[model samples]
Target: MTAVHGDPILTSEEGPIRTTEFESIARAVDRETEGVQVELIGGRLGVKRVPDGDHGRILNWLLLLLMPLNPGLFLHVIGQGLAVGSYRKGRARPDGILAPPDAFAGAGEWASPDAVVMTVEVTSHDSDTNHRDRVEKPIAYARAGIPIYLLIDREAGKVVVHSQPDEDGYQDLHSYAFGRAVSLPEPVGVTFDTESLKDMGD
Candidate 1:
């Protein structure tokens, strides 16, 4: 498959992929899904889905419920691409994406599809949570310069925040439990309610 942006064409090479190539592929992908996120750059191609088991569904619903609380918060459901191409390749559908007003203000393409304020991954049945959260994603978002990373582990009932990406990986790391509240990075300072998540007694 190809991701097309303007006249160029892009595809994932399963290795060190270029930004321009990824952008082209992003624009070329079929805009067919009602809620699917189409992204290019990082590594993989096609539709990359969030872990959508029972817990995944509940966390997704809770993310949708976050809409009313933070008006500045914009929720991109299960399979929506956030950034296009700049650092990595492939589209990762976070359970929900919380973007501030300024980030969502512009009409046309704002930043890259991967240019998101906060990216959340609600863990479901993944046997290797650390792999996705600590290893692969760090490379992807760090390269893209994503501001913050939020990972919710339903099995462990934990919410981990990896904020401020640096040359290596995330700088600030914080973990919270069920009844705790996590405050997002600046410009918004929105306190994400962990209590309202899927199995957390919302």
Candidate 2:
């Protein structure tokens, strides 16, 4: 079996185990293993496959678009984690994140959501991955006071922009199909062209 990040590696003969604390996840991140991503969800460690080729392409496109538009802000891709909610109850590793350059200055392995201007997630092959990005993560990001959350649903071939977050979930949500243009609100003031985004298999 191939080794996936965040999942337990059987270093000893004791077999597989899951990390249950935020510190453990942080320590794993400090190790800096390649092709591995770790997220702390509801205080439990979760491992996921690194972003595939299509995911990387979309992220790069967004990075390029954002750099010219928001020259002062920083753009972070996969492997950068954000500490969400109070006391780091949840940690989210987004496909891409836009924030101030000093956001995590002198900070630890993860950054607080307060520092994030916007976050993006591209759906993976797993249904749970889809649900996390579409359902759970939005609520988490909202609760953490993140202003914008962009979910690229490869399975649905649509991009959903969520904003105006309150105590509940985002109050505003606009979705556009693969070929349409989606408007991103202020702070990240720009309209995104989803026409070039590749579908799941293509």
Candidate 3:
């Protein structure tokens, strides 16, 4: 479990846990652990493994492609926990959050999604990648009104760009294999090549 994307491990029927209790649990895990990230999505707890070297490489590759294209925007990782899902109740920490610089200023752990234009996720090697990255996330990001949800699916060996968010999920979708290029829609106008991912290992 070395990829950046969180591995979804749904908790057993622990009955109904309050938001305060969920936050307390997440804080304890984050404080005591070293290479784990906790998320409270859909009222269930999920643990994310520490990112491996390939994950770091992909992140750096993204930086090279985005910096020159959008100087006014920024991409945040690790510490940028987002308030996702309906009513901003669910907490999610994406691989990278794209927004204008200073969007998270004064926003503590879980920030609002108002300024978030895009959210990026890099799939891990775990079997839960399909459920977590492909299914749950699209709904959560859309519910949060994030304009774009970028899925770098390592297993699928493709880049799935989700945009045109509606109440349920993204209305528009375009997928490109590792060797192809990707074009993101507006509010975030940028296009890039994903050919280098061919060597990144699925």
Give each model a TM-score: 0.63, 0.81, 0.91
Cα lDDT for residue 96, model 2?
82
lDDT of 2 by residue, 1-202 (tens): 2345334332322113233344574566557656666565544445566777987887787788778877888778746777774344677788888888777777766667777889888887653575467776888788788899988888888889999987677999998988888898987888866667754324
lDDT of 1 by residue, 1-202 (tens): 4322221132346645544554554455545423223444346443343344665565566566666766766755534455522344444545666665455445343245434777777654434445554565655665567777777767667777888876577888888886688776654466766666535422
> What are the candidates' C-alpha RMSDs?
6.5, 5.2, 3.2
**lDDT digits (tens) for residues 106-191 of candidate 3:** 99888899998899999876656676779878888898899999999887788999999887899999999898889989888998
Better of 1 and 2 by TM-score: 2
Report the alpha-carbon TM-score of model 2 versus the true structure: 0.81
List per-prediction Cα lDDT, in the order shown.
0.56, 0.71, 0.81
lDDT of 1: 0.56
**Clash numbers, per candidate:** 27, 0, 0
lDDT-based ranking, best first?
A: 3, 2, 1
Angstrom error at residue 6, model 3? 7.5
